[model samples]
Target: MATLPVEYLRTTRLFREKIGDVEIISFEVPVHKYFSRNEIPYLATALDVDFRKMENLITDMKYGRVAVEKLWAYRMDADIIRENKKVLLPDLASNPVDGEVDEFEDAKVLKIHVGPLKEYVRVFVRPRQGFREVVVYRKPPHPAFVRYVAYL
Candidate 1:
């Protein structure tokens, strides 16, 4: 329906002139990515990735993660995770249950699953419509973390 904001369009155009758009935009693992600094080690262990080597990759911030509007358009499936020996806190096990109205107020609950090992994640688009974020209920073993080592 609506394209990006005017300011974004302007800055993004300037950014394009400065540096061309890329198929994948990447950045080092944010030091403050998790709520607390203490949670990094455990997350590294669970994802089977080095804490220092982790990173966040989005298709492109300007056009968003994908050509599609939906935020969850790009995903790493269980098979991919398992093959890489990258662990998922909330695996198919843990008796994960979808979220109800109370958990995520106002915003549409895309997917929220909870388990005993604090294994679950709630990936949802905010009520503001264009906002997007990933929420991991458990911090120590971040449920929505993965390490992607690729030549591309």
Candidate 2:
């Protein structure tokens, strides 16, 4: 398979270190856009969080007041939008649909852990005929979420 480039809105230098005549710079880079064989994209944000906070994140997602049609995450892949699972993001209830739109109320959230340190929150939506199963991983809000919250 061919490699794919990750998407980023921007980048910034974090810090610089110098030793004698050599200097090194550090940058806080965005995570790669991981893709399935079918080209579905997902990005996982690393959070050095405790179990309690992870639980809280899930609880908040289960019962959070989300805005309508807001762009919570940066990458809104075409495959995800086409699946009509875009509602799984903090943005929902406003995306145009053939009929009634799917909201968080119409989905199920599953909390899963891969190892002692890796945990994932996945949301599954109602299945539609002739379409792939809709599964969206609930990640931490993108940096833009706070930066543009007022405008959104």
Candidate 3:
């Protein structure tokens, strides 16, 4: 929807736990750049998420709507990702911790049940084409994806 390229959309704002809006610690990099097993370390450091967990999430997190504070259909171009970040970054920074994880196994959508959020921040990464949307959200990953949260 916007004209600016998704340069800042280094990571989709799919997470709210570690870094809300990926809380964007300035380590955000291109989505494609984070796929390789070797690249996992850099991606983990940059995003501030656990490297081992991220690797697992990346491998298993495909074709699902990761709802954190909201639901997002992964994959976007430069323009949309840019716009969403610009609008949502501020609110994400201020999001309170009063949230709940809503699990729906049948539908395959895991959501963070935070009530009454002001504004919205959603990143759009361009699909490489011929690939299903995988691990749409980076942080605050699905409960099942993380044994830590699943057991709790």
Candidate 4:
């Protein structure tokens, strides 16, 4: 099986503010686009929100708004876009489905559903391989929901 170029992995951060008192931070690392392989990590250190509270809140909020002061800070500094565009764009553009599925013996296409959203993400991976084709189709929640979810 052929290996997907390393440039496929990508990350993004989401932030929110509350009544000038507290701020919330969340980060997402897309494993295969629709289905986030990992939960968003807490980026704010001073927030009083607890883990349980935040977990419950994630279901309600997807991408709140506190102003995306920086969308891809680390990537920008690394010039990842320009460096990997040649290999990345074609792979992302080729697959349009959404969701995850089991690996097969031949080149197989699968879709993975993400969260509570009624959307599907498509992925194409090499048969019986660990890592190959992966991409994310982000459909963030409403602005207000994002703000509330950030607290989670």
Candidate 5:
């Protein structure tokens, strides 16, 4: 429910491994921003971890690959508005006039589809005020996409 400004976006390429016929790679995208100490505790509590240890947990990343496993985003409860602060309504002129807007509560979380590789990767920013955690998940690639990426 808190609004934290985004300050940094980073990507760390982790090790790559092949298991049988499958390949797995890991990456960490950290987002750094500013937030109050009170907000930090709430985030820690939500993740069911010690608040006091967050600094080292994020900085040193003691949990290794496991640390990136619990990645998630909270669905926001507000409506998107325009820069003028107007409640800009949906475009009824368009076809398929479904009233509902596909509002993604967590804008920071990104799902990337690498078409050539036929692979999907999930990215999210962990709101730590001064720092946010970015995690990506790579799913198995489709046969066509695999061949496409290989050619690139």
Candidate 6:
């Protein structure tokens, strides 16, 4: 885990999206920061996905050309952490914990049917620790409590 810069904590914008009973909150970190030695403390490993392919998948979903499925499981894959990094975005990436929704106790799973490719990242959203909410957004879900929810 990387320690976020104090400035990022203060200046980074946290975006919130509400999907049904879910509230998805997220923020973007400048991708360039990944290379900065000074910002290393605040960075987590970026998702190494085929950016163009994933982008196309997202576009297809937006146009109703692709199928999306919601799967509920007790655990989520560690790779899910990468989705929150927003590595597909041009300038920004996601912090792993940004999607954990630590504010809620109930965690639900959202599985986007990106074929059966084991290499693709899986994203999910659950309520914050105390409230009942689910999050859906342009970005992916954050796996905040990964140790507890991590899939073997």
Candidate No. with top lDDT: 5
Instruction: Order candidates by TM-score, high to low.
Output: 1, 3, 5, 4, 2, 6
Model 4 deviation from native, Cα RMSD in Å? 17.6
TM-score of 5: 0.24
- After superposition, the stretches of candidate 3 with alpha carbons farther than 4 Å from their true spots are 1-29, 35-95, 105-107, 113-134, 137-152
Residue range 76-105, candidate 1, lDDT tens digits: 343543543222333222233444333456
Total clashing residue pairs per candidate? 0, 0, 7, 16, 6, 15
Question: Candidate 6's error at 147, in angstroms?
Answer: 20
lDDT of 3 by residue, 56-148 (tens): 555543323221111232223225445432112222233432332233332222222223332122112222243222232333222111111
Per-residue C-alpha lDDT of model 2 across residues 1-152, encoded as one tens digit per residue: 96653322233334443324433332332222211111111111112234344333333332342211112333334343454222222211122112122245544333433222123234344333432233445343221111011101
- TM-score each candidate: 0.25, 0.22, 0.25, 0.23, 0.24, 0.21
What clash pairs does model 3 have?
A: 6-78, 19-23, 20-23, 61-135, 76-124, 76-125, 76-126
Runs off by more than 4 Å, candidate 1: 1-89, 93-98, 103-106, 109-120, 129-137, 142-152
Pairing residues by index, what is the TM-score of model 2?
Answer: 0.22
- Off-target runs (Cα >4 Å) in candidate 2 are 1-109, 114-119, 141-152
Residue 80 C-alpha lDDT in model 2: 38
Question: Per-residue lDDT tens digits of candidate 4, residues 51-70?
Answer: 44433344333343221111
lDDT of 5 at 151: 6
Q: After superposition, how far is residue 57 of candidate 2 from its true place, in Å?
A: 34
Q: What is the lDDT of candidate 6?
A: 0.28
